[model samples]
Target: MKNRPFRERMGFALEGIRTGWRREASFRTQTMLAGCALLALLVLRPAPIWWGLVAVTCALVLALELLNSAMEAVIDLLHPGIHPSIKIAKDMLAGAVLTISAAALVVGVAMVVATGPAFLAEIGL
Candidate 1:
């Protein structure tokens, strides 16, 4: 890849996000869920290591979603007509996203369990 200025690179990345938001429902859903997780983290004020794990896991899930979107776009462009190989490739890309998403779900649950009691008590639960 050509080394470009930071601002220019950010513009391209932002465009990708815009496209994904418009084209991929799953992307939007995952982003919303991640946002909620971050909000919970802010409320809980978890340990630094927990924050690191949440950040990394969220990033990984989002990155894999972007990759899956990119792959689907390319596959459709190259083979609009049905083919078994293309189907397999698309399925595998989706599977990768699903696997990462499942891992993120586990991390999210752990975070809630670790902090839920304190948060609930603060709310007079």
Candidate 2:
């Protein structure tokens, strides 16, 4: 099959998210959390650059999780037997998701810390 263009690839990715949101509890939870975090960022009015970092990092983690899920699905479809190579591939992809999630958490905390004082002050705390 010919490689899909970038726009087509993005469309497929959006479709995956739509399907996942309907079927996957974890995806729904993460999306809900992302929505909450976005609201906080807007209400708190964090430094513009830090807000961008947090938003991008959160999106990256979610995107990585989606890709990891797709990888596992393809591996299972290709080889239903117990295969060390397939196990390794799936584990590595999962590890990538973990790493990205951890990084996103760190960035998110940093953004909150950087802006928390101002937010509190504005609230008359």
Candidate that scores best on lDDT: 1
TM-scores of the candidates are 0.88, 0.84
On TM-score, the candidate that comes out on top is 1
Cα lDDT for residue 79, candidate 1 = 91
Q: What residue pairs are clashing in model 2?
A: none
lDDT of 1 by residue, 12-79 (tens): 99999999999999899999989988997898887888899999999999889998999999999989
Could you tell me the lDDT of residue 64 within candidate 2?
80
Clashes of 2: 0
Regions of model 1 farther than 4 Å from truth? 121-125
Runs of candidate 2 with Cα error greater than 4 angstroms are: 1-11
lDDT of each structure? 0.91, 0.83
